[model samples]
Target: MSQPQADEGIQTSIDELGLPLSETTFVVLDLETTGTSATDARITEIGAVRVRGGETVDEFTTLVNPGIAIPATVTLLTGITQSMVATAPPVEEVLPDLLEYLRRDPGTALVAHNASFDTGFLKAACERHGHPWPAPPVVDTLRLARAVLGRGETRNHKLGTLAAFFGTPVTPNHRALDDARATVDVLHGLVERLGPMGVHSLEELRSVTKPPTKQQIAKRHLAEGVPEAPGVYVFTDANGADLYVGKSKNLRHRVRTYFTAAENRQRIREMARVVEGVTPIVCATELEASVRELRLIAERKPPYNRRSRHPERVHWVKLTTEAFPRLSVVRSVKDDGAPYLGPYTGLKEADRAREALLAAFPLRQCTHTFDPPRRTVEPCVLAQLGRCGAPCDGTESRADYTAHADAAREAMTGDPAAVVDLHTARIRKMSAQLRYEEAAALRDRLAAFLRGAGRSQRLTALAVLPQVIATRPGALGWETGVVRHGRLAASAVLRPGTDPAAFLASLEATAEHVEPGPGPVPRATAAEGELVLDWLTDPATRLVRIEGEWTCPLRSAEAHAEMTHWAHGRAPAQ
Candidate 1:
């Protein structure tokens, strides 16, 4: 694909838009059903004609035994009586043939007068008969007529009206094949009308029916060079500053929607108007595209792309590096050797985890530092209420405070049984005292702690591994990834019949060397690690090699599962 020059200024040639309408295959179809409601209706007749460049290539027509009597009203309207379908094949026997006809040519668009009605009945038939529905791109002639024709040019946007207006040789008479043949002519007429309005390609034709805004129509050229493959896309301003970052499996189709009325978000529409150019970076697979998208959003911090920009802003519950250590919610994890509990997405959840730790241990909540161990003459409210041992006031000895800090560290890193027991006991006591709200609040705090602890343990299990190589079968080949310390170091797609062992060795040799850092995710953000972990845990994934054990503690997993059940109002497993 040729890249557009910077000075072109959005003047798109009709040839660069997409597949031309003249070269596109259209399967114009019509269906006669027993009723209008898809759920309650049965298709009695299916008729479709394949047309290309204003010429018919093939035709398909079939009568289906609905197995249900056709209503008298439906019989009068469609002339498909019960007797006519009694000798015909059932829908199950006819659907496979129709599906095969539809898939005969790839990129064939399904055209109908009111597409929803016909497509709805067909989809319902597929569902009822346990057949897979081939979800095809649809073009409704009625919608096209409404968009292209003026009110004075047509009486109504119905099939018969369109047939009369277009001077079609075949007149629609509510019979499937005849209506289908008439619709083919009507479709050609609408396409002819759209030609003069810059709707030359299939993509433009689809968008033109939406009657896109002026900004959208003007900026449609930005999507011209994007290839239909999985990858990331960056939208930039004229000055080359990043405006937005996104990813899609089909880069061209997804990018084109932004220049059409289908993109309904106001912010996105405004972003589309200011977009000066689009940069497409094609990837080997969808997973690679997702990981790259996350990394780009974090690195660029584009104004239009929300989420993942402030990955470092995540909160962590840490044991503060002070003489009298206490649980504190910090925004970052450093290599200070202090135990960390989480990489929580929200400060509120981190605070809840901290509160849960404080409930179990009498750790100081104050932000004061005591390097020289200065003692206060007056104790704070927490100390007076016996919630704290008044370490600042010298009521608590250094040895006693050390013990509390040790237990807190253990709860954060190792076993959390002490904290769980303390909180559960408090909840039971509060419930017995008829303080339902306080009990509920305590339960929430405990749940939050469990969630953070569980996530931290799961991530640490993967982050501690020096290297892990895994693969899964892809459409064209095998998709493989090299991970180091829970970060995606490298990824590749090996063509089918390629030797897996050799490919794995080559990928590992050139993969990124990740130096171990601190916290749950040693070399990557928590979100990125989670994405990698999801890929690793998929049942289809085959573990080729591992440098270290990849497992979470049984107790931690159980606690997380128990908390999940309790949070959802279900009884915890025995």
Candidate 2:
């Protein structure tokens, strides 16, 4: 590798360099593949120009028999007919010859117009032949041209366009040799434009524009169809292995949103390139979609998807069993013997609830601890305060403690509205009778009910637990995207209709199924919480109705049943 330098001898080799350039050499290559994708397409042509020490020392260009009929679209693009490459040297025969010519002396880096596309084809071809190219840095002249000439000067950076701009002409046709020559001229002009010392070396040129990679095309994108179907969808490769899973109500529309509206091109491109196919499953309802989504995430555990390893790490409270049972907070849900109340966020909060119930109205902390044989340690603080309706005193009956324990547990989970009404009535009676403590207890109970009521939501019956729910309102219907973590695993599209065929279609289309779970409860007060409640309870809530694609839920009994199973778990086996 050599370049013309100051005080250099007047020689043909250095003179042929076309400029006083750097020692770095470049291998410019081109290919005609059977298709746009490297993996699915075969290469039919190979062309290259090797420049060492700024001199075009060698050239390699040939048509390779790709062993397959070149698609017409590619033929039109490259003009290498299926017949032209049919009898040419096979890739195995020519690749060796091509490599030897290009890699003989000081190794030169690869160069191409749209490097990502060419590299993809070459990589796929080489990998298929079991002879991968060595990892070499790339020098993209397209980028060099763009930088040397402002973007405003040219709309497209093709060789002929640049050649015309610089007035360095080529006489041969659009063959590999001619294109490579034209490209070299473009490179020379760029170096001159940048100035000899301007771009110190070819290495500096490579530094400017890195080669391309697989890019998601803009063809499949549909800008307006986001918030698509509320069912589940699974993305897969050609091998049918699940790459990712998701649920959406508007099936067709939501898939398009990723390709169209998603802001992250890198992520979308990865998803699009890897997603060779899609699997869609319509759920009975949105709730079922949620359940299905979780099931898919947990089951598939696709590479990109993640979530909390232990659900209870978030916190909760549980009620354990005993004659004088304790109401305590548990950090994790375990296979403990008694029915549990929650898995709550803070022990301090749990303690506050405990004190509220005990000081004003004392109850036992533990049933087992107060047992006759002294179950464990000495009875705790409850026994000291007369707070314990204790079995330790041998006076507390199992039935009496059991009733009080059940009442407290019910106060936590049972319908707070019903409890609120009861407490309100009792408080009024106490107030009227002038019994302050009684009225005060009833007032506290009523307040607790009101707070709990804020957490409740009445979703349509097709809902379930152990799932995440997302909603998208469409012209035809509500589209729900059910997901767990970030990957889509399953979905359901429930339309309002009586058509049994459509109903069954919706059920069968479900991506993956999950056990239904309750809707998320409000953890804090905000307009968002109020908004969700209003949307749920609003009688006028409506979805845009699409014709044959989806029907309204109002007209379909099958959708109703599907929605119920989705919201609630499937009926207990028999």
Candidate 3:
């Protein structure tokens, strides 16, 4: 089997998330402080024991002059008086050595009985004295003991109670070093208890105390087969029906997160309860994973996926193919050859685009279909208002009505200068007259039209292309994709040191054959086409070959992006 390559800037290995407890290093530490509140406390002593595989490797102990009087209550508790630390180094001097000890072993997790109390004082000291704190992974034995041991097994989860229950050789004294040593043994005891519960890895150990739902725990096995790589994952039910579809750069890590308490989304938790299996489809790059995820969600319409499941529901402003062409808001694009202005996600935006086109050109806005030469019926109030050419009556000739339809089509498909210029002039006139609200409304309508027009133009540009081959550098080799008609036809990773030309030839031969369809994005959904466009326009992507022109209209949405920003009551980009 071919090993999956890591996409650039992503870690595609499970090592970090799957490091076994036996192979993990832990620095069990305790701090003696003057007060309980971390913000008000000052550390007087620090004690730590570095251990791996349940064996002690080294120890760190220190006394620091806290530069503040040690409270009598604290002194009574820990027994280290001010005079005891009087000749000792100040906290500023002690922090460097302590930080060094923590940094000596990379990937070492910190362990403590009441970890927050200990870590808080140390972090406060490091911050006060201007020493950078090494924020290591922390394991709180107090929380772990509470999570693992029953009340019948232990009276309390205190350090002394746990140490006595575990029968550790070292008992917790008031002093820091003895307490740290006792905590280490307690940690080992907790680990032993967790082992049978399947908490074997350090990552699991960290989140085990919080505990996932029983359903999540039972479904964890679903993540076992997912490799750590950029991919799309589908969670399916017992009947093999898709429940949810997701994409991730690290499939193993992301899938495992769902079975941990870290994944707190309530909907996902419910989905986890019914998830019978996970299907992982590895890809050559993150872009391909994203595209595939979009395609799968659209195809399966999974219950757990809220977005992209209803691409067919996307609204479009279509110029109806009738005797008198009028703008119509539609749910789906068909191969009827009528020009469409959008895959608009909202009906209101499509209406606004339709209104903007009608405002610019005197096209009929009514749903009435005319059979020909002209009707003798009375025109609606819109004709008297001059918003319509009154094609329903004999007032507007067929040739003149056809001219308006042609201009509207040009604005929707080729160039939007007429619509944009008219809206701009209207907005300027309204602004000059201090009718700002009406002007803003017109601006919104104009922006909606431009947005749809720009998107339609961009997608049409890519959809017309017969083929486009692009590549970008990946961690293991060259990440490449063959796109035809705005859809991903094939994708692969050319291993490093391989001949690029030969790989390209092989990829082109095996690429999926896509027959061009009608509308903006023929072979794929608009969302998928947009994703492909994003990948193609990425600065890192290089065009290896192109079968036809791969360019947007000279005056598409991008050209007026700043103008739209200004229209939306914001300053244009500098």
Candidate 4:
């Protein structure tokens, strides 16, 4: 079957037409039912009035016959008895005309006191008659009343009580048409109270609240000059101190949301009262915005930004250069000539990576600072169990122990093939002996080593570059940036009509002013470098220009097809 025509369809139009609430059309409806439960009872009468421009456009009222007997309690409450509806048309017979009446205006908003009750019975009736139930947007007067009038202003926000309080022209007396007409008056009264807030649009009316506290309403002007572009924004107090720093794809929407009652964060709600103004720094891409946000939070030490303010606290897995070389988790990557594997999330992950590396190579597992040729020391239990080289005692030669230490360093920072092959051979031997638990443990270690080594290699590769231009697809056009050492030096958007050569010239000038970093590498720099690597790895990203080569000289885990086969227990490639 074909879809119904737009004008004749049951769908309600929500287009605002740039019109105020007074000019918008609303259909106030009411139903007289046999009982409260829609499933157990039936609608005995339907009453509706369509109001537009503060005047009635149309009114519809009809008696509907329920095939079942009406309960006596319903007759007393609603005055709609079986005798009154005995000769009326059944609900199935009246559905077509009712839908047509409701859809007379394509852009109508359906209204009722407790909307769910009437709309529920109407929806069931339409579904029963095989009519396409176009789900129209609803405006519940009960919610509107509670939101607009405080408890002291009205006795209780019931239909009859509200109508009496407003002195509506029509009084509701357990009758459908009278109740609907009274509801129309109540709607207009509520909207009249909302006019001062400049909430003229239907969308605004649907979300309107009682006049907000003076604090929340006064801060609305802070968002007036914010742009509809990707950027980082700062909220500052009256004392010129940073309260919060945030980033968003749309600066205007994100900043404005903070000044509304809808903001549930107690801290932000308190911040709104003190926020004097917003400062927006537009960026070429959201990636740049995120990097800028991290930098601003770290520098300004904003009280509201608790997460990324301490990137320096992240831990790294470091290999010590002592005589008995072993792994240790350190807070910073110093200039000490030891190979570093992370900037991992925390000490726990760094420890796991250290364990994986130790599983493959028998490096000294002791905590002691070794004095070579000291015969007073005994070998630790790990040395007797073959988990470490017995360098504590004189059993392992210096040359032999140095070679093993170099192999461990090579696996983490150089080739990685030595550790990869060792774990592979161990896993295979365990499987052959039917030692499944041992084999599984070896495979997990290999996976952890691969994950850490791959990330470290990629980050280290990007962190050494002097300057490069990276581009990714965006909604407006190509989002491009010039990155120096791992930091975003300058950024630009290359739209369709933009001159590519001119864009590069401006970017190069900006890059020149930025002291090109082969700067001290910190955990913060590594975290930002991950963002750059993500853009570079995308197949769609085009490297428009480069001053230095981007290379991962060491073999990446992604290069080995057989590694995945062995990891997943699949047959090796032919």
Candidate 5:
């Protein structure tokens, strides 16, 4: 047996989606067929190379019997004559081996010069043979070449042209294996070209060819100076007013994507056409970038950003301060000590949470404003149906209603044990009865309840913590922040060898410039609270100092198997 040929300069790792270039496995492939049209043609030969972290790992090359005459023109074009494939295995045999080789690793990405052409033939072959096809992530070097190369760089985008342009050691000889080897070189070359532009992951590489509109292409230079690091970016019009604000781990790549077809939103395209320049604020971490993006959108109220533009729009499920105390979805959180649960994304989610709480607790359902001394009142339907205590009709005592309200408050702000227990039993009963739709509805309510209650408990815990400093390691240095009463007070980048004492002193100085208020809650907006929660929960971040205890007495009601069974509507694991 002969050893497979190896390609060079392919090993380097840049991680995205937790899988880096160095760790990824690629299968570069090519096919020679009986004709140009995949619909009419049959594959005569298949060639491929498997590479991992820049080094060639394995090679596959085989001639396939097409069970059709080799046209003279096709033979002349590919140099694969009828005699060459006379004794070779059929496509059915060759396809299984090719698929098996590709499946040797989980992170394998299929690379081809014109991927659709080759992939089309392979898919047809699989279907004809009744064999299952694995549709792995495909990277088309032809599309990538167009995206990376300028018009003057290549005469035309062709496999041989690219092979010659990149100076690959092996030239394509119209043979399957030789062309595939050349394509492997081209793939690596294009990936190297894309690295600086922040094309580091499989997802980015696959979507690189989404061509920008003509208007967007002209304004592409606006992203020229954007850094390739986690940060928030603002797009501004000619008048220097902000048009749109976004955050990304790779600022340059993300900003560039706005001009490309990858950004499909019409509003974004309109914003892109008017964008004159970009302003980026480099942050210590992605969490910081996300928080800054939310705050910027809220402050600027840019027309392009729909979400986070109006933090006040997010509804909260609040227990009213009225004597009856009904559960209602309200927009604002008051300074008064009433139990509030949410920052829910919309009215629907808040209503779902409210319904779940109502199902579990018997609180007043009427929307009446009552005075202490009233005449005979007509009871509402809920009161007549025994769902309520008939507080409106004055049949229920104020003390009895108060007790029910307290239970609801506990379910909303503290332990959701009452709500969780109720839903779990209902879900189990429905599941046993095979009432799938009802079970699903009950499951959704339970999920909403737990989500709201958990968020409230988390916010309450963080709000009570007066002062703390959190730190995480980043690309440049340590990312440090001083959070007072759960609101960011100060943030700084601490370079190594710089004295910790000096950094802390400067951080304290910056803290004086910090905005006041932990607010009435731990976070003013849902986004802000989410950022704090992410920072606090990150296993990598260390708490350097604290003025008060950071703790929560309440726990999420999701410890039960019911949630696990019904989440995503999947059947429970045996």
Candidate 6:
């Protein structure tokens, strides 16, 4: 089915009634969907190739928010995520914009693969978003595929296999807009071979988008042939440069629709300018297509691809058992295994918590703020109120002061055993001194040990392990997934591969500890681990790698509770 590029698909009728060689405008539209049923699924990406006569022109591509979280598989297939789309101007915002662009001529025809899916997505998106649905003149090469290639030409009429059989040059397959553009190439080839239709006028081509006659509908299905059986396809330029990529169940029909639409002027124009080829890959199922598309996009980072552009980067507060410790903030997790705070949004948020520690705990204000005596008099206001365990005045013994500093450091940094050790030490000292009141306080804090250690459930899992975390790769966002037992989970989101040992180390001060030989057998997924081992074991090694992600996970009760709290307004820091 092909519709006019506008509500009307009247191409310019010229001298001798010839198609506009460079003026017969057409839009090649493509849709990225949730599933096979265009009626039930939402569109994630929309691209179209514009063409005039036989010359390609321009292109239009956009990632839609879909008003829902993209499935992990879908994200993998299209590289379209909930966040990439979060700020994406909505479809309603773009549809009108597209309409205005197409209305430039007011009579161009619209084309798409299986035109129904893209058109369906368009219709639904318009209706759902409070926009009017207009019928535009359209064209479908799916009809051409059947008529030109005939019913018994191939076992299946897949866009790729068909292109391959017909000798169309396409490679690096399957992306929404890319495939739509490629289908145009196929359509042109077919039309060239088959000659003009019975109704050769632009009006005749425009009639394709309207409700087809029963005979036409039957013929349309036959032309659609065996649905491509769900797969991914890629659209490329004449030089094989990727312009767009896409996926669908029936590649033949889906690819065919784009060649027939008229509203696809922008896309058609873009494709005409850059595209000269296509590539398609059939998947075992729709799910496979979605998954493969995402991975391919993520890896390739195509010119038109979006998402993971700026991976999540966070500022962290470091808490260490090292000397002169209080609370220090940095931009990333540190190395040296001292256990630091976060990859948070900013220093201000971390500062809020730092203030709480200074007010509530009797910890040293500064390591050397009083060194050499800056005031020459009092220990400033901190010592006056006993808030400072007194590094400011030089009155407190180093032994006693540093001990309290260590304990405070423990609390601020969220060290689990640190709580246990502090509690035990305080209890022992109080017992010797007969200070039962202080000892009891330590006991209560110990009971809340698990509460503090829990840290509001970073767990992304159900009653399971944490999963679905985000990380940064240099300046890009990446997501890593894990499987605990048989259940899938996303775990430990980080940035830039988590290989910056110095960066992670900066988050915390390390206590100079001597290791007892080469530690136990290592079984951790750490970039540091990979780098260090490679450096030491084989100095010649030039390669090292890391990973990260962010998403809802199947985690333990503790983590699930935390994420739930965060998603709502009940977060701990809040």
lDDT, candidate 6, at 36: 59
**CA displacement after TM-score superposition, residue 65 of candidate 2 (Å):** 75
**Over the stretch 173-208, how does candidate 1's per-residue lDDT look in tens digits?**
999999999999998888888778767777677766
TM-score per prediction, in order, is 0.62, 0.34, 0.63, 0.57, 0.64, 0.33
lDDT tens readout by residue for model 3, 1-574: 9988653322234543466788989999998888888887677888999999889999999886765678989889999997898777666566778888888876788899888888888888765433557777788999989888987998889899998999999999878899999999999998998888767777678767654678886777777878989999999999999999999888988898787655655799999878999999998888789899998998889999887898888899999889888888988788888999887888888898899898889988787757744456788999999988887877898899999999889888877878878888887787677676677678768777877887888899999999999988888788899999989999999897788889999999999999988888899999899889989889999998999877766766557644544223221110
- Tens-digit lDDT track of model 2 for 106-187: 4456777667787777666555433547545555677677767886887677777787887767732446667777777777
Q: Please report the candidate that would top TM-score against the real structure.
A: 5
Please give the clash total of every predicted structure, in order: 0, 69, 0, 0, 3, 108
RMSD of each: 13.8, 26.8, 16.4, 18.8, 14.8, 22.1
Tens digit of lDDT per residue, candidate 4, span 255-347? Answer: 875654334356777777888978999988888898899889878889987657777787777788887678887887776778777666567
User: lDDT of all predictions, in order shown?
Assistant: 0.81, 0.51, 0.82, 0.74, 0.76, 0.48
Q: Could you give the candidate ranking by lDDT, starting with the highest?
A: 3, 1, 5, 4, 2, 6
How many collisions between residues are there in candidate 2?
A: 69
lDDT of 2 at 244: 70
User: What ranges in model 3 sit over 4 Å off?
Assistant: 1-211, 428-437, 564-574
Q: Candidates 4 and 6: which is better by lDDT?
A: 4
Model 5 residue 13 distance off true place after TM-score fit, in angstroms: 21
TM-score, model 6 to reference: 0.33
Please provide, for model 5 over 454-523, each residue's C-alpha lDDT reduced to its tens digit, 9 standing for 90 to 100: 6677776677676678788877788888776656776777899999988987887777333324323644
Decoy 5 TM-score against native: 0.64
Candidate 4 deviant stretches above 4 angstroms: 1-218, 370-376, 414-448, 473-478, 495-499, 512-524, 553-574
What C-alpha lDDT does candidate 6 achieve relative to the native structure?
0.48
Better of 1 and 6 by lDDT: 1
